[model samples]
Target: MSCVQTIQDYGLRSLGFGERLLPREGFTLCEQFTLIGSGIIWNVYFGALALAAGFLLATVLAVAKQSHNRWLRKPAEWFIFIFRGSPLFIQFFFAYFLFLSLKGASSFFNPFTSAWLGALIVLFLNTAAYTGEIFYGALRSIPKGDIEAADAYGLSGWTRFRRIIWPTMLRLAWPAYTNEAIFLFHATTLVYFSGFPAWQQKGDALYYASYFADKTFNPFVPYPIVAFYFILVTLGIIAIFGAVNKRLNQHLPQEARRKLRIRPQVIR
Candidate 1:
């Protein structure tokens, strides 16, 4: 088949569109690209939704961790420590098992066993803890003089936090937050590999890549294709986050603004 025909046949294959069975034999370059590209929709879905939900939760976590009251602070501290100290792989396994046990208890909990809900829950909490630490550090690093300035202006409690403290914390944390965002996207590939089963062969980019590899005994082709798609997606993330980071740092002098860098470390 022509390249155009192959693309047309498999472009939306992940969504149960176009080609139904995938290229069984004679897997062309066009087939690999189209199928893997189609699989990317899952990655984007997991990453984007998890990031959006995690941001709000992280903000609350950061605030709670910084609270003077022990009731609020201790739980937040323990949460951050627990999530951040453990491996995400283990988290995925434990979460899947936990959900499985819950499903055994009742039909209502069965939905938690599925990839869509289970993976999202794990990713959300993981990202929240990581981003919470970043925001907490930024909150602590907020210049002491800023608080005094807020006090001088009679900006107290919610008003002070809303106007001055929160903005500065986000500004300070934006660079690290961008790094967290990138890692979270990469982490989505782990979902299918974990305990969550990819129902109906519907899976992410890495999932389909692994499937092809096992079938043809050729890791070289499929894995590289998966990596290429991830690289493109990662670059797209950097672009979007870079724009937001720029806006966050816009008020500062050019030299004072933090430059975003990618340093993948063990946060999950």
Candidate 2:
């Protein structure tokens, strides 16, 4: 097939539109690009939803961990420790089985059988813990003067946090959070590899790349295509986070603005 025909067939294949069955015998470069690109939709979905839902919970966790109240602090600490101490790949497996066991226990829990909700739950909690730790460190590193100044203004409790502490914490944590975002996006590729079924070959980029490699016996072509798609999206994510980081530090003087840097994290 020509490039245009391949694009027309597999462009939206991830959504189960055209080309019900993936190309088998005659895999072309066009097919590889189109199918892999289609699969990227799932990556974007997982990362975007996980990051968005995790942000507020992560902030709450950071605050709880920092609280003087043992009831709040200890639980928060344990939650963070449990999630961050273990591999996310392991979390997905455990969560999938746990959800299956509980599926019939309640009607509200029915959605957990599917990857759309089940895998998302795991990713949300996982990213929340990592982000919480980052925020906790940033919270502790906030200048003592900032709190004292809030006190001088008769600001306390939520007033102080809303107007003073939270903003500064976010500013300090923004860089690390940016890296965390990229890492989390890369981590989305593990969803299909885990217990979660694609439900119809509707897997992510890596899944499609592997499929093509298996069919064509040319990992060189499909894998590079996956890398190309990931790199493009990763750079786009970095650019978006960079803009947010700049706004977070906007109150500081030009010399004090923290530059965003990409430091790839290795889980092992």
Candidate 3:
């Protein structure tokens, strides 16, 4: 088949559209690229949803962790610790079985066992713990002078936090948080590789790459395509976050504004 025909056939195969059967033999470069690209849909879905949902929970956890009240503080501390301390692969393993047990109790828990919901939940909680710690550090790092200045302006309670503290915390934490966001997207590859099974043949980019690799007994071609896709994703992330960082620091003089320094995690 022509490359365009191949594209039309497999472009959205990962979403269960276009074609149902994967090509079995004489795999061409175009087929590999098209099918693998199709699988990226799941990766983006998991990463985007988890990142957006986790942001709010992370902020709340950060505030709770920093709170004086023992009730709020202790639970937040343990939640962050448990999620952050364990390996994510183990979390996925445990979560799948846990959900399976719950499925026995109630039919409503059925969806929770699937990767769409289960893996997303795992990623959401994982990112939230990591992000909560980042935000907590930013909260602690908030300039005392800024708080004093707010107090001088008769700002207190939620209004003061909403106006003064929150923005500053975001400004301080954003660079590091950008790194977290990148890592979380890259981590989506682990979803199908983990305990959560991909229904039918639907899986992420890594899943498709692995399929090609196993069939051809050649890891070099397909794996690099996966990397290329993720590299583009990383660039897109950097562009978006850098723009937000600029806006966050827009009020300050250019010389006073902190430039975003992307330090990718070598080992998470």
Per-residue CA lDDT of model 2 for 153-259, tens digit only, reads 99998889999999999999998998999899899999999998887898889999999888777789999898898899889998899888888887889998989
* Candidate number with greatest lDDT: 3
Per-residue lDDT tens digits for candidate 3, residues 1-268, read: 8999999999999888888899999999999999999999899999999999999999999999999999999999999999999988899999999999999999999999999999999999999999999999999999999999999999999999999999999999999999999999998999998899988899899999999999999999999999999998999999999999999999988798878787777424
Number of the candidate with higher TM-score, 2 or 3: 3
Local lDDT at 23 for model 2: 85
TM-score of each: 0.95, 0.96, 0.98
User: What is the number of backbone collisions in each predicted candidate, taken in the order shown?
Assistant: 0, 0, 0
Which regions of candidate 1 deviate over 4 angstroms? 265-268
RMSD of 2: 1.3
Worst 10-residue lDDT window for candidate 1 reads: 259-268
| Clashes, model 1 | 0
| Per-residue lDDT of model 1, residues 84-135, tens digit only | 9999999999999999998999999888998899999999999999999999
The global C-alpha lDDT for each of the candidates, from Candidate 1 onward, is 0.90, 0.91, 0.95
